[model samples]
Target: MRKLVIAISMLAFTGAAASADPIADRQALMKERGKLVGTLSKVVKGEQAFDAAAVLDALKGLEANAEKFDTEALFPVGSEQGRDTTAAPKIWEDKAGFNAAEDKFLADVKAAVAAPPADVDALKGPFGTIAKDCGACHQTYRIKKG
Candidate 1:
């Protein structure tokens, strides 16, 4: 009886500590991405100094982080530590499509980041496309919290 109680307590504690909430985690990543977007925008719009090399550096971080959101990270269904999360319950029901969306978004960002525009004017179109893809994924997968 004492052993059972200890085991239950340990399981409960572990569950609470490890609830992944990937939706929340993704939102937090986006918040950081937002800052990068703003900085990129400033450079693109001619409002700030233009630095192609700096753009590349910032983009590398976004690319690395974004890669994590693919199939496993987003649909985290069978995971005990990770757990199914605030990402709409629909995600599990339609796994393939969700993963495809992630793949497309990842591919788009990779191409966009690989070749940043030369001047502010040139950056606008590509930046907009990149941001739009981000919006697309968020809209489909993320649940609005009230």
Candidate 2:
């Protein structure tokens, strides 16, 4: 019963926290992706010992965010102007291209998740590919923060 109460409370808190602030919500989502990538990067760079479970979890998170990137609500109109968003105005200007970039990212993430690496060495290629996808999207759609 205690566990159930805690779980319910956490859910309620999360729901309230998410709110209607699309910029904040999307920023939070991107931060989560960054953290997952950082975790995998540590393993890849030999800063951390290879952990298959952790690698798989991070891949799953990346895949989930890739899917979320497609959701229209995640980038509501006018969301780019306010908040500390790195999203560039070009995203709204070139909506089709922005969505195409997201689609490519989703496909790359799906491929990585589908064949999770068994070791850090094995992860290097797919991880690099996903990183490239992120860079490509960021180059076109995201503004650099000063």
| TM-score (C-alpha, index-matched) for candidate 2 | 0.85
Pull out the clashing pairs in model 2. Answer: none
| Global lDDT of each candidate | 0.62, 0.77
Question: Which one wins on lDDT?
Answer: 2
Summarize candidate 2's per-residue lDDT along 1-146 as a digit string, tens digits: 32443344345435634797777667766776787789888998999999887788778777766665544787878787886788898888998898888888788888988888999889999999888888898999999988
Residue-pair clashes per prediction, in order, are 0, 0
Model 1, residue 87: what's the lDDT? 69
On residues 22-107, what C-alpha lDDT tens digit does candidate 1 reach at each position?
54555455555666677777777778887766666555545654664545663466432243344665567777777877677677
TM-score per prediction, in order, is 0.65, 0.85
